[model samples]
Target: MGEKRLNERVLSPEEFVSGYQYITEYLKAGLPLCDVLKRALKYFEDQFVDSYCTIMLLNSKGTEFVNGAAYSLPDDMLEKFMHIRLFDGLGTCGTAAVRGELMVSPNVHNDRTWRSFANVVKPYGLKSCWSVPVFKPGTSDIVAIFAVYSKYSRYPTQRELDTLSAYNELLGLIVSNYKIDDSGEIEQLDLNEDDNLNSKTLYVESIKTGLKNGEIYPYYQPVLKSDGQELHGVEALARWEHPEKGLVPPIDFVDHAEEYDFIDWLDEVICRRACEDMKKLMDDTGKTFTLSVNISAVHIRKQNFAQRIEDILDETGFPADCLAIEITETSLIDNLTEVAVTFQQLKNLGVKIAIDDFGTTYSSLNYLKYLPVDTIKLDKTFIHDVDKSPIDRRICKTIIQLGSDLELDVVAEGVECDQHLSIIQDFGCNIYQGYYFSKPLTLEGWKNYLEQF
Candidate 1:
């Protein structure tokens, strides 16, 4: 790719140092930031004649900019520019704030990014705008923006742009004063709390809409035989195809759904999709494999937990025995009797139960002795260092032995390379999963994977 060209004019070394020293003195003197902003804007405008200066800072949510201080800008324009949302093609300041880069529009009338907000600036006789995002020192978090608007269509000189670091330093010093106390405790900036809440609310609602629209679905990761030669089963993992954000990883929104009573419905969606994919694979290749779907503790606590599984199976025509419901060790620890009942009811319906993420929760394996689980999934920690650490190897060997004694299959997770595979197989784990075989795949990707056998 070609180097990104910025419209910058050169400034003298004395000019750059003078600007830096001026801002530094104000910050060191502990002047009120509002006063500092006014003085700073005037100083910048004096250096670059026929220019107006404005400052904007990110609200608590970090999605938009709030007007901080301005010099030589019209009162009418100031009111309209009070809040500028960060988005693609959202004018000079907004784009710079969102993209975390320097934005220079030599001609607002000609720039596509200025299309939406051109009229706001054109009326003020501003033809060019240069914006630089101010980030917190040693962090990517943008705290504010410092911009200059000029009457002529031109970009800042290279020498003038060199002072951006000084601008950022001053902006950070001022913005930090807005949040951090004398004791250095970060105080809540309630200025945009409602905006942040609204943004999150919309995001959560979008997930709900995505689920309804079938934009959210399952991606299958194969659980393989210990030697990594055959597909034993595939675990259904949820993924969201967000319109704006692209493919969002499950970690971003999985807990959001679980928190909002949406996971139960999402669980059904995953089950149905898994069933459909499995049925298609069977018809295409006549090969049948087990399917596992994770069940959250909240879902297990539901009164209709077992019945919900049965209903999904009957509704989707998925084989009952071919489906395994993975409940975590933490779930069983919470409501022992209730979970026992839930598992027993599921077992009666021929749905296999596996303890997911074993060894991470309680050290007590008392629940394992009573729960009717067909498999015990050893946590990733056991395999992460099993090859080099004797303790990890011994712990894994003991877990596999316990599973063997109880007539239960033991699955070792995070089996990444030859060492993990060799160590895990030696420990007698019945199945293993991780990058050694393959990472999770979409339905089409999994079909290609299953085509081998």
Candidate 2:
């Protein structure tokens, strides 16, 4: 690392900031961003080697990642890479989208997260990477990314930060001006409300797409009644061991049911797997505990909701009392008044409801008057902030008090750190769930996880 060589390899702040301002001023002058990027690369080439840059503007819809422009990139490479929609491990652009921040991949080839896109991005000798978020002027929603690249490993200087600041502000203006069109984003499935969709039919596909193919399966996240560290229950988390696509997390496709009115099948699939696992666990360990699965509003609206549960419980030979149904307030609202009668029927059969994502909505508290839930699980958003924000602490405290006064148990979800544990312990919320104890694991995995206790 000689002085002049190091100075040239790493960006000088003054140079980077000056270059940043020139690009912004150019864009503000009404030049299309692609043209502006092209001009900026030309300017940088005349000045420094930090001229290789890519301006990735998000589609008008925020759903997918799109590579719109790359300065100094081969035209063919740009066109080919641009077609890649954003997803986890989907190269630099998609990783940035998921983390909601600019991730610098100084060497995209060696970074495990971006390894899949290596061949596509490595040919340019792109060793240095810089990505800065372009956001709406006063909002957190990131509209795009202005990624600066170099042929060597480069770190940002003060001048580089200044350049990024100006670049982001200018890019924000361009993004805010573009109108979002979400057409072609959602594909509608065929079949009517009365049609009992076949498991093989694409229309019947829910988040758990591979259950029919035997790839989608249940994993249990162990829940301990804190302090005693005793296994009280487990929630079934679904995973897709895709043959070609690799492992997929629930956040990736868990909403397909709510999105396509196919939630019922997803709920049923997870329920069946969870009940079967519970039965096996009881037989093996002789320690039976509750197993909770989420129920969708889509299934609750069906006339046979109660009978459906009975069928599954009997089929699996699992105790009806050893199960809990979790539902969100939004799902509760989907058919609240009508479903209340059905929930009451299930309650008579010893099924308890835990309101998931509680306190995330304003209407959650009021629903206690209408629903016969046995527990109110505090949403993690409030728990995450319990130590920092006074408002969140007060609300959580009030919620615990409310649930206690209503004679319903309060389970604090996302109880990660000891601070969260201490806080809830003070609030008399004895039951807790979160990654600190353990992340969601397969039933076989849970047996190993339980060894800690």
Candidate 3:
């Protein structure tokens, strides 16, 4: 096979930061190592053109490679990788594992190291391969191999290699902290949680400063009527504006805040900021709009949770009746009785309550029977495929009916197109929120968006 030269592309600094932040969020969320690896690869593949990525682990004896995760690679090819032993010139990944360094084959056909895998890769038209060994942190022990494949033969620029190296380090952190069980479940090892937090104390402190500096604030995503003709409300989402990293996504740090037992502080900051912003928006626009804020389970379970919310309303002068507190189904699993008490207290203050991401957890429908919920936002997973999947459509229709029978507002989440809107309308869901209307926007962006209406 002849070599085919292709234009080289490198990941921008912003792209690198965003991708790293995105994957770190999953790791912090305690997702399975394999699932996190797959998502990490997907992020890279989406950034690069015609690229595929895979991760393979070193066995306990460090003798052979085992499947960890692969993106868009055929099972037969992945099966071949399982038998690759660590040795010189065995294959790109195998050789990288043995040498404990990065390996590159600009053209697999011309690289003698890939001679043994020629037949295996030919079917997929894999022209180039780059492999980097992921070592255990603070040690030279090889734990995993991260590889990227391309259909066109070309050498990667230095910048591209640097990006790979940066991500390789992150993979090391993930792999070193997690392990796969015999039942194929990803279980977290008994790593000392306190030690982990102590190690990242600077990061935690930075968040505290970030809030005081106004670096952490609220962004709003509009929730519209099912007809897409009028704005029903807006959801306040927290975002971190890192001075150097630009916009750090909430996923990257929200869980970290929760783990460090300071989520209550962060939640209060967001709620107060959102109330102030929404109050101003309502005043300027002369249009009353409901404001929804997601409260962490940690904060909601407190003995004085309702009192704190009432204080923020009093401080910001935001009407209590026009505000909604969205609680996820998973949050209600632990302390339903206590949470219901808080819900009733808030309801007594004229605040509305909403069950966000409803149907994602195993919590019984008895929640609706006991809790004072005014709305249930159907989990986006059901709405995402409502236009195509019969099962999703049925679930959405059933949820809408249930909401109606209970005389509660039903808001469909994740309506991204006209088809989703039409189908949701048919199901009699009059409230909608999703990218179909607009993505979450900064305060200025939200102001501009509302001005148009």
Residue-wise C-alpha lDDT for candidate 2, range 41-131, written one tens digit per residue: 5654454456566666566555564545655776456554454566646565667765667577767767786777667667877776666
Alpha-carbon runs more than 4 Å astray in model 1: 1-192
Q: Write the per-residue lDDT of candidate 3 for residues 292-396, one digit (tens) a residue.
A: 999988879967899989999999999999999998888788889899999999999999999998877777487898999999999999988988999998989
lDDT of 2: 0.67
The clash numbers for all candidates, in the given order, read 9, 2, 0
lDDT of 2 at 105: 73
- Candidate 1 structure, TM-score to reference: 0.57
Q: What are the models' TM-scores?
A: 0.57, 0.54, 0.57
Models sorted by lDDT, best on top: 3, 1, 2
The CA lDDT of each predicted structure is 0.75, 0.67, 0.80
The 10-residue segment of model 3 with minimum total lDDT is: 1-10
lDDT of 3: 0.80
Error of 3 at 206 (Å): 2.4
